[model samples]
Structures are given as C-alpha cells and as structure tokens.
Target: MKFLRDILDKVKPNFEKDGKLHFLHSTFDAIETFMFVPNHTTKRGAHIRDGIDLKRTMFIVIIALVPCLLFGMWNVGALHYAAQNIDSTLLENMLYGAMKVVPIIVVSYLTGLGIEFAFCQVNGHPVNEGFLVSGMLIPLIVPADIPLWMVIVATAFAVIIGKEVFGGTGMNILNPALTARVFLYIAYPVEMAGEIWVSGIKEGLVDAASGATALGVLGGKDLEAASNYSVNVMDAFMGFIPGSIGETSVLMCLIGAAILIVTGIGSWRIMLATVIGALGMGLILNAVGGNPYYDLPAYQHLLIGGFAFGAVFMATDPVSAAHTTTGKWIYGILIGVLTVLIRVFNPAYPEGIMFAILFMNVMAPLVDNYVVKANIKRRLNRVKA
Candidate 1:
C-alpha cells in the first residue's frame, strides 16, 4: 500500500495546491516525469490550469451538437417512412434514421482517429481530441448516403494532408472537416453534388414519391412567390425538407451555438457577424429585383440551407479561423456574404456552406495579418504622440 501510495504521489500533482485540476495534467505530469522526460520546465509561468483542455473543449462541442444529431436521426427515419408510405412510430422512424447515420459517424471517427493516433505515436506527442468534433462534423456536412469507402479515403486525406502535413492540431491552415468535405466533393463529384444525392426511399422499395429541395424548387419557381410570402421556407427552416442529415435544422444548430458561446468555446462575434453579412446580402438582393428577389425578406436567409450550421460550427474553427477579434469579424462577415452570394448566384449548388467556409479558410491568415498590423500601427502612433 505504501509503495502504491508513493507511486501515486509521484505521478499526481497536488491539485489542492493549485485549486484546480486540469484534465490531463496529472497524467501528463506522470508521463513526463517518469515515462518520457522529467524536469520538463513549466513554461509561461502558468499556474493552475483549467479543468478544460482542448480535448474537453472539443468534447463539449460534440455534446452541444447532440440535439442536432438526434433530430437529424429522427428526420432521416421520417423521410424514409414518408417515402415508403409505411406506418411507423416516432421511435421506429428514429431507429431507421440511426441505421443510416450511425454507420457514417462510426466510419468517420474510426478512420480519422486511426490517423490521429498514428500521428501522435510517430510524432511522440499527446493525442489531440479535436478530431472528436471533426469526425462527427464530416458526416453531418455530407449527404446521408455517401459511400463508406469514400468516407474512409476522405477522412485519411483530411487528417494527413489537411492537418498532419502542416503539423497537427493548432497548426493546420484549412479546417479539417471542410477539407474532408472538399476532397470528397472533388474526388466524387457525382456523390457530393446536391442533385445526385437522394434522401427518401427508393422508387420500387417504397411508395413512389419525388420532390426537389425547397431551394431547388424556389430557384426554378417564378420570382412572384418569393416576394409574396415565406412559402415552403418554414419546412426548410424547421428541417423537414431533404438535405444533409444534420444541417437541415437551423434551430438545432442555434442551440449548439448557444452552448458554444456560453462555454467560451466559440466566438459570438463570428456568429453574429455571419448572420448580419448574410442578411445584408439577402436584403440587397431583395432590393435589386434580382432572381432571388422576393418579399420573402432578408431574415429568411438565416433559416435556409447550411448557413446556420456552417456559421456556428465550421466557420469558427480556431485553427482555420481568425484569432484576433477584428480578424474574426472580418472573416465571419466574408463567410456570410460569400455563402449568400453562392446560394443566390450559383444554380448548381443549393447550399453554400462548404464553399463559404473553404473560401474564408484561405483568407483567414490575411485577415489576421491586417488586424495585427493595425494594432502595431496604433501602438507606434501612440508612442510617437
């Protein structure tokens, strides 16, 4: 017992001393002190690390995302049931939905985490839990019926090229989730394109039914309805319409956003800025009497497509997004503007979240550069005065 106590004493720090217990501090301390390298100088004079680490941070995101995920599962089953014209209890429908979505989640996590673990082993560093959120994110952004092998390839590519090659975790330039989506988009154009993907049941197996997405229907419809009222926009907003599994529900995404902001895991500036930018562009189109012109109003933009989901989750990626407050505003606004632009102007892709996020990823560094320079310039001016 004394021997065991001595080992514990050596491995574990006195948390009472610091008044906090950082998630892995004791374990990390043990690994360093006994296993790897002792005398690891605690740099930054940082005392009493918080209980939350990046892993916990990422895990919180996953937890916040649960509502959307559960809703998506139920929705998937609902769509299938509706298509098949079969009587199903809500629970049964949800099970059917889970049958489809769960595998995608499993495959994504397994493949992405496999890569992350290998990299951690090779690099001799502790594993980052960022992929926990990212793995779920990849499937959520993709169509429900995406091929499993494709998921594997995309996950590997995103983890290796999108992240590890640039150096893991905080070093990557592109959002790893977006990276996986982009690779899948380019590599399997037929799969990722909105038209090629199908949500409801197949023709023979179920009752025959066919319906275009609200966006597609609206795009083709006379501009008259857009001006008159919201129309089927409510269905899209509530997530009854067919689209990606998780992204269909703006309300659920907002719930996740609320948690993220409250927890300090995500930036509210980016979230608000994105909504404003999207609304701004949407209102402008309304005023111009353009194709998307409608009395439907600007606020509708927030409920449509993947705008809410992307702004809340994908756009706020700490690694690929702006670190500075000013830079975050700029980055977020551009994403909103670009998302609205793509959704309105491009007839090909109904949702613009993927494009908007990737476009902003490229510009994040420039945004930061200018923000930092402005701060420096102000400091110099102050010194001169």
Candidate 2:
C-alpha cells in the first residue's frame, strides 16, 4: 500500500506551479474551464480571454445552419418521394436526401480545406476556422444536380479570389460561399440556370417527375399575359417551391433565423429590416398600377427564391455586413429592396440573392464610414454644447 501510494505521488501532475493536471483533474479542467471559460496564461497584449475561440465561433455558425441543412435534405427526399407518387415517410425521405447531399458536402469540405491549408502554410498564419463554416455553406447554396468538378473549381475561385486575395478570413469583404455561387452562375450558365431539375432514384413503383420552379417558370413567361402565372403563396412558405437546394423553404429559414437570433450569432435588425424593405418595395410596385415584371404579390416575393436565405444568413454575416446598429438596418433594407428589384426588373437572372449580397458587401465599407462620421459629428456637437 505504501509503495502504491509512492508510485501515485510520483505520477501526479503539479497543478500549482505550472497549472498542469493529470487524469480526473485534466478532465474536469477541460469541461469546466476550457469549454466554458479557459484560464490560459496570456503572453500577448491581452491578458484575459473568453471561452469563445475561433473553433467555438465556427461551431456556433454550424449550429445555426443545422436547420437549413436538415430541412434541405428532408425536402429533397420528400420532393423525390412526391415525384415518384409514393407515400412520404419523414425518416426514409431524409435518409434518401442524405445520400445525395452528403457527397456535395464531402466534396466541398475537401476542396475548400485543401486550399485553406495551403494558404495557411504559405502565409505563415494559423489555419482559419472560417472555412469550417464556409465549406458547409457552399454545398447548401448549390443545386442538388451541380457537377462535382464545378464545385471544386468554384470552391477554389471563392477561396483564392474572394478570400485569400483580400488578405484572408476576417478581411474578406464578400461572403466566400456567395462568391462560389456567383462564379458558378457566370461560368456555367447552362448548369446553374433556373430551368434545370434533378431526377432522383426510384423506389418500388414511385416514379419521379421533372418540373421547373415557380420562380423559373414566372421568369420564363410574362406574368401579365399568362393567367396561370400566379404561384401558391403557401407552398412557397412551406418550401415546396422549386429553387436552390436549401433555399426553397421559407418556414425552415425562419426557424434558422430564430436560432441565430436566440443564440445572438445573427443580427435581428438585418433580418427584420430586409423583410420590411422587400414588403415595402413590393407594396410600392403594386401601387403604381403594378410593374408587369413584378406581378407577384408582396408576400409571395418574400417567400419565393433565395430572399429568405439571404436575409437571414448572407446579409447578417458579421465580417461582410455593416457593423453599426443603424448601418445594419440600412444595409439590410437595401439588400431586400435590391433583391426584389433585380427579380422584377432583371430578365437575365431569376434569383437575386447573390447579386444583392455582393452589392451590399462592396457598400459595407462606405456605410461604416458614414456611420463613423455621424458618430464623430455627434460627439463634436456634444463637446461644443
């Protein structure tokens, strides 16, 4: 017993001098300290730090994205099941959707991470956790039928030009995932066009059918001339409407928005302002004898296309979006207004989220500048008074 106690003492870690712990101590430390609030000795300028490291921040983003991803997968399978004229089982449909979406997820992570690691080594900076969130985001925005090689190419372009060229990670002005979508849109118009519909695997007698999204159909025809051009607003809200893989369901997107808002990871102002702006613009367009181009109802415009996705996710990105409280409102409203405007007026592109986000990204710096100037003027007036 004495010998055993001696051996244990010899192996015990010094928790006082170096703050090192062994076994149970280390486990407790990791749980109560590192995960909750780490107490690492800071050698740099900052003395204290919170538990929210980059990894934690990246994880939070992934958590917020969970709703959309799960919904996208289940929706894909459900659509395929519906196409086949079969009875829907939620679990079975999600499993089927997982089979298709998983590959896209894998390809996106491998390619995006490959570029990210190379940049980290070359630039002598630590590997950024940003790509962990971005990789998932890229695959979600793409269509279920998008080719694998195109995904690789788009990932490369988005990482290199959209991020690395701008000095990487937090310095980037545009959302990397949006950059990938834009590249694919311009480079492969045939593949990325709104008309393409995917055929899923058949089970038993259930045969899937090919059809176009309401937005795509509307874009193809003049709404004023076509009596049946109007889309079911409820279907769009419920996410049965055809669009991008993860962008179809407005209901799911709202759930995601709620998670983001509750976690304090997303800006509620941006979300609210964008919706208000879109509805406001839609009402304005409706009042002037209606723009033939935008014959869809105001609420319908919000539910269709990538408007909800953009307003909730892309527009609220901390790095790319406006930082000031007021700037967030202005920026978000502009994104919504532009999204509707582009959808209504621009015949070349049916979906406008990508353009709206990119346009706002460029304007973010200018918006911040004006916001800062206003703050300074207010301070100066206060001093004089």
Candidate 3:
C-alpha cells in the first residue's frame, strides 16, 4: 500500500493545476479517490466523519446486488436452452449465461461511465460515483437480449437527460437506472417486450409461444378472466420464470434486501411498508374478485414481476426516496398500491414497479413536505398549551 501510495504521489502533481497533464485532472482525481480515501477534509465544525462515504455506500449496494447478478446470469443460460429444447450441462448453462449477460454489462458500464467521465471533464468536476451502481442496474432491469446499441442509447439518455439535466447524482429527481429502462421500454416496445427476455426468441431462432412473463399471462385481455393462471407461482418465487435478468428470482432479491438492511444502508421501514401495502392491495382485489388475475394469492404479487426488486432496490434509493420516517412509510405504501393497481388495471403494460417507483420519486418530496408540516403543527399545539 505504501509503495503504491508513493507511486501515486510521484505522478499526482502532473495532474494538478498548471501541470503538463492538467487536462486529465478530473480523470486522475477520480481514480485516486476510488483507489484510496481522499485526504481532503473540512477544517471547520461539521458532523464527525467515518470510513463510510458515497463510494463506500454505493459499493455496499453493489455487494448486495451480487446474488441477483450471479443468479440472473445462470437463469439466462438455463432459459436459452430450455427455449430451444436442447440438453445442456450446468457449466454449459453458466457459460452461455455469461456470454449473453457480460456484454450487456460491459456496454452499460462503458457507455454510462464514458458519458459521466466526459461530463466531469467538460465541467471540471469530479466524476460522480453514482453510475457505479446505475450501470449495473440498467443491465439487470432490461432483457438479456437487449441490443448493445439500445443499451448505449439508453445509457446516454439516462446519464444526460435523466440525471445530468437535473444536476448530477444526488440532485437527480428520478433513479437513473429506471430512467434508462423506461426510455428503452417506451421507445422500443417490441424490443423491450417479453419475447426478447429469452435469448433466441427475439431473433426468431426459437419459438416465442411460451416466452410470456407471469404478468403477461395474468394481465392478458384475451383470457377467460375466471381461468386459473397457468404459471407456477413457486417457479416465479424461485426465479426460474422468464422475465428481466435480475428480477426473476424473489429469493435473490431477498438476499440483496437482507444485505442492505443488515448494513443499515437500506430502509427496513420502507421495505416492510411496501410489502404490507402490496398485500393489502392484493387482498382488496381478491375480495372484489371479478377476475382470475385478481384471484391470484395476495402474497404472490411480491414474488412476481419486478415488485420485490423495486421494493428492495428502487424504493430504497436514498436520494430519491422520502427521507423523513413518516414520509418513507407513505412513499413506500403508495409505491406498492400503485404497482398492484397498475398491474391489475393498466391495459398497456403488465409490470408496474418501474412506473410506480418513478412516480413516487417525483412525489417523495411532496410527501416529506406534508409530513414535516404535520409534525410542525403538532409541535405548535403543544407549545401553545
């Protein structure tokens, strides 16, 4: 460590002001900060510091997401061969999954970081580390077969319009990963649709007949509304079903959730409230019980589609989520209710977590504002007494 520090110290001055390589100072600073803790500190009174910083927080999140990533890779491979009715070994499946998932991940990081680096250089600012997480997220939320070009365009749009326009990272109003996903989903519906989730169906090499997601089947308009949903809920729970890469397995999402909660980075209040709200809504639909989709077990909503993923990951985003304790409960419950509401009622889309989280991101501040005001009002009454 000392030897590496000495090496960095030797070249550090060259990237400082008026140095020959000063043009790449932001790049240098970014690398230096990533590799080691920044020495810069406030001399004045401020909150006491700790080892945890933004990068560390984001890194922890990346750690939490690993279970989902690894499982998503294997799931993709397993599904590809399953779709084609080909016998394959576990190693072969894992390898095939790697081949498909890795390129998407590479494209995501390269495109997002490329834009982030460019923006930092142009504006003479330190590169924000937010994309370290967003880059991974964008890949997870999209189809495994999603085009590299689409990943490039969505990543650029996510960095520029979704985040940069609102001032970078912590200032962005919406989650950047979901921004990339929603952009691709709206702009290229066919490409972003269920068929592409399985590797070869989108290319016409495999039949698309069985490629539908649980949500797609449940929400189908052409069904006998009273017919039993044919999908195995347990498979969906285990994440063996066709869907977005990282979102398939409820078990993996739970593992990620456990890590975030244990580390105290993610809000357990939000997680619990989101589940309660979703189950409550599901129960409401069950009582009204006009349709087979509504008749699905209330707990199953949390297992299917992106509900669990969004609750664990998207709703827990510290920046966009409501910061007030009361506000978080409100924000999370609304996300749950809205997600199930849209899933049951919306004709255009089957999944609702993406829209649900984004909408709450926009409304989170308002929820916090009201919570603050209510608290102030109660305090004023006590003071007057």
Candidate 4:
C-alpha cells in the first residue's frame, strides 16, 4: 500500500491545479480515491464526516448485486441448455452463460465510464461514483443476448442524455440504467422483446422449448392454454424461468435486498410498501375476474417478471426515488400498482416494472412535495392547539 501511495504521490503533482496535466485532474482523482480514501479533510463549514463516501456506498451496492449477477449467469446457461434438451455440467453452464453475459457487463461499464470520464474532463468536475452502480445495473436488467452494439449505444445514451444532460447523477430525473433500457426497448422493440431472452436459442436446437416468459404466457392466452407454457410458481421463485438476465430470480433479488437493508443502504419502507401495493393491485384484479390474467394469483405476481428486481433495486434508487419517508411509500406503492396495471391491461408489454419505475421517477418530486406539505400542515395545526 505504501509503495502504491508513493507512486501516486509522485504523479499526483502533475494532475494538480496549474500543473501540465491538470485537465486530467478528475480522472487522476477518481483513480486515486478509488484506491484509497482521501486523507484531505474539511477545513471549514459544517459537514458530516463518515467512513463511507459515495464510492464506498456504490461499492456496497455492487456487493449486494453480486448474488444476482452470479445467479443470472447460471440461469442463462441453464435455460439455454434446457431449451436445447442438452445436459451440461454446472461448470459448462456457467461458462457458456458467462460468455454471453460478461460481454454485456463489460461493454456497459466501458462505454458508460468512458462517457462519464469525458464529461468530467470537459466540465472540469470530479467524477461521480454513481456510474459504478449504474454500470452493473444496466446489464443485469437487459437480456443476456442483447447486441453488444446496442449495449454500447444504450450506455452512451444513458450517461449523456439521462444523466449528464441533467447535470449528472443526483440531478437526473430518471434512473440512468432504466433510461438506457427503455431507450433500447422502445427504439428496438424486436431485439429487446419476444423469444430473444434465452441464449443459444438461435442455434435452433429444440422445438419443445419455448422462450415465452411466465408473464408472457399468462398475458398471451387463457389460463388453461397458458398452463401449457406457465412456469411453475416454485420454478419462478427459484429463478428457473426465462426472462431478463437478473430479474428472473426472485430468490436472488431477495438475497440482494436483505444485504442492502442490513447494510442500511436500501430503503425497507419503499420495499415493503411496493410489495403490499403490488399484492393489493393483484388482489383487486383477481376480484374483477373477467380475464384469466386478472384471475392469476396475486402473490405469484411478485415472483415473475421484473417485479422483484425492480422493487428491490430500481425503485429504491436514492437519487431518483422519493426523498421523504412517507413519500417513499407512496412512490413505491404507485410503482407497484402501475406495474401490475400496465402488465394486466396492456398486453403489449408483458413486463411493466421498467415503465412503472421510470414513470414514478418522474413523479417522485411531486410525491415528496405533497408529503412535505402535509408534514408542515400537521406542525402548524399542533402549534395552533
């Protein structure tokens, strides 16, 4: 450590103010700070000092996401092999999955960080740590088989339009990862949707296996007909179904959720309210009972599609989500309700959490405003008494 610090100290002067390489200050600072916490401290003004900085906070999120990434890789390989009716060793499965999944992750990080670095250089501002989490998240939410070119384009679009255009990270109105996803989904629906989910399916191995997800199956036909394609609830719960890379596994997402909550990095209030809202909406739909999709079990809704992943991860984004405690509940519940409503009512999009979260991200400030107003009103009433 001391050796590395000495090397950094030697080079650091060149990137400091008024030095020949001063333009690269943000880049140097980003690398140096990532390697070790900054020794510099505040000399003035009130500031809360903590061991955890933005980089460490984002690193914690990355730690939580590791379980999902590993499980997603395994699921991708397992689904691909299952589709072809080919038995594969677990090692083979993971290797094959990694071949498909790792590139997307790499491209996401490289493209996103490249743009972020460019922005920091141009603006002469310190590099934000937000992309550390966003980079991992973009690949996780997309199909493993999505084109590498698309990943590059989407990542660039996310960093430039979604975040940088709005003054970067904390100022962005939408989740940058979701923004990239929504861009791909809308601009290239054919590639983002349909049977493209399962990797190795393009090899044309088996006719018996279908790439239609559980949510797709339910939305596509009546309950009896869908039963032929429906993934068992247990399989969905266990993440054996074909869907988005990381979203198929409710179990993995829950494990990630537990880690985030335990570390105090995630919002439990938002998570709890989101689940209740989804269940509540599902129950309401079940009671209406006109269509087989509506009659589908409420609890099952939480297991399938992107509901679990989005509720645990996307909706709880600290920057885009509601800031006030009460507003978090409203924001999360509305996301859940809207997700179910969109899935059930609009059969065109089988997965709704992406749209739901993006929509709620836009509404989050409005929700917070109302919550704040209410709190002020209550305080005023108490003073009057």
Error of 4 at 141 (Å): 1.0
lDDT of 2: 0.79
- Tens-place lDDT digits, model 3, residues 309-359: 999998999999999999999999999999999999996888888999999
**lDDT tens digits, residue span 1-385, model 1:** 5775577566466432353554445334434443332443558876886667676798899998998899888887787777667788999978988888999999999999888877776665666566888998988887776778999999999999999999988998999988998898788876675453345533355442243455655554456644443546667678886777898888899899999999999899999999889888888888876454333467877876677889999998888998899999999898888887887777666667789989889889999999999999999999999
- Residue 64's lDDT in candidate 4: 89
Ranked candidates (TM-score, high to low): 4, 3, 2, 1
Rank all candidate structures by their lDDT, best first, as comma-separated numbers: 3, 4, 2, 1
lDDT of 1 at 237: 73
TM-scores of the models, in the order given = 0.84, 0.85, 0.96, 0.96
The residue-by-residue lDDT of candidate 4 on 1-385, one tens digit each, is 9999999999999998899999999999989988997787899999998887787789889998999999999989988888887999899889988999999999999999999999999999998798999999999999887879999999999899999999997999999999999999989988887677788656665342478777777777456776455458899898988888988889999999999999999999999999999999999999888877887789988998999999998999999999999999899899889999999999888888899999999999999999999999999999999
lDDT of 2 by residue, 1-385 (tens): 5775465446445433354553234333322332333445767685666676777777887887888899888888887778767888999889878987899999999998888767766665656577888898888888876778999999999999999999888999999999999999999997787445443422233232245766676666556543476677788888875556788888888888888888788899999999988998888777764445455678888888888988888888889999999899899899889888888778788887679889998998899899989999999999999
lDDT winner between candidates 1 and 2: 2
User: What is the lDDT, from 0 to 100, of the residue 113 in candidate 3?
Assistant: 92
Model 1 weakest 10-residue run by lDDT: 30-39
Task: State the TM-score for model 2.
Answer: 0.85
Worst 10 residues of 4 by lDDT: 200-209
- Provide the global lDDT of candidate 4 against the true structure: 0.89
What are the runs in model 4 whose C-alpha is more than 4 Å off? 206-209, 221-224, 227-231
